[model samples]
Target: MDPVTGSVAPRKILIACIGNIFFGDDGFGVEVARQLMIRRYPSHVQVVDFGIRGMDLAYTLLEDFDELVLVDTVSWGRPPGTLYLIEPDLELIAQAGERGVFLDAHSLDPVKILSFARSLGAAPIHTSLVGCEPESLGSEEDEISVGLSPTVQAMIPAAIAMLDKLVAELSFAKKVEVTSKGAT
Candidate 1:
């Protein structure tokens, strides 16, 4: 426990980086994970690059964690490289039905993964996504691209900043929860 805050010192945080490195800007999440690995985070924080492994991510969700942060490339029809921080709506997930089906092995579908996890048992109470808009998912020749485009590459720092802010907010919320529990 933290004496100053009267709360637990660390809350388990799972940062799941989801994407396919072979698909140009779709590799954004993988790159973010690579960059974050170079830095240090609290011991309770587990950062992993799932990299198109939807099933693996679903299984990881079974582990106890206070929060889950998903980083990926999202197509929201904005400019290429636009960053977004979204708290996925559980209501929508619930409405989407519970089925653990994937059309492709390389598909990085968070909604499907979450549904599968929920079906298994419990999922993290808190979840957020740091997403980037992609300019191109592959090469002009319709072949797989190995790296991100220039615009997407430039947004990495911005995405990292967003992730940092989200982490701080989750930490504060955890402290508040502990303080309230102690008071009661």
Candidate 2:
């Protein structure tokens, strides 16, 4: 079921954490998401950690969901811990474009992941990226970015704020749809 179209059973939202945690700031997305899961959200929201697994996202396409929010660490000229909602930037893709190069130490390349998701027809109503600056990408084995810069820690609140905004928007939309259907 395509979440963007709202024609699926069991309204659901997906929050995907796509990053390599051991790599300094690169793991920001996954870490933030972990923190979010500690709270209780509505049953409709599905939070998943897609750490360095690009191909695994393919399976996610099979699920019927109403929205998808992707969280990842990306360099957007902000200080470490700074978060940004990244739209598909052609220039950035072009700058980082190299055949199969993982965006960071992580296994999945960010651009490729988006492209793959599109090819599979997995479109969501609103897809947003929350990113943070990295102080250091830790060793390969640990893959946990260490000593998240002060800026990076500060961005967590803003990131959570964005999630809250999305939740309200999605919930409102669902309510309106139900009301319209009842009227019909």
lDDT of 2 by residue, 78-155 (tens): 566666765445334334333433433348765666545545655423445666666556656544545455667667
Q: Per-candidate TM vs. native?
A: 0.86, 0.68
TM-score of 1: 0.86
What is candidate 1's local distance difference test score?
Answer: 0.82
* Span of ten consecutive residues with least summed lDDT in model 2: 175-184
Task: Please count the clashing residue pairs in each candidate, in the order shown.
Answer: 0, 14
Q: Which stretches of candidate 1 lie over 4 Å from their true place?
A: 1-5, 99-103, 140-142, 174-184
Give the clashing residue pairs of candidate 1, or none.
none
Report the number of backbone clashes for model 2.
14
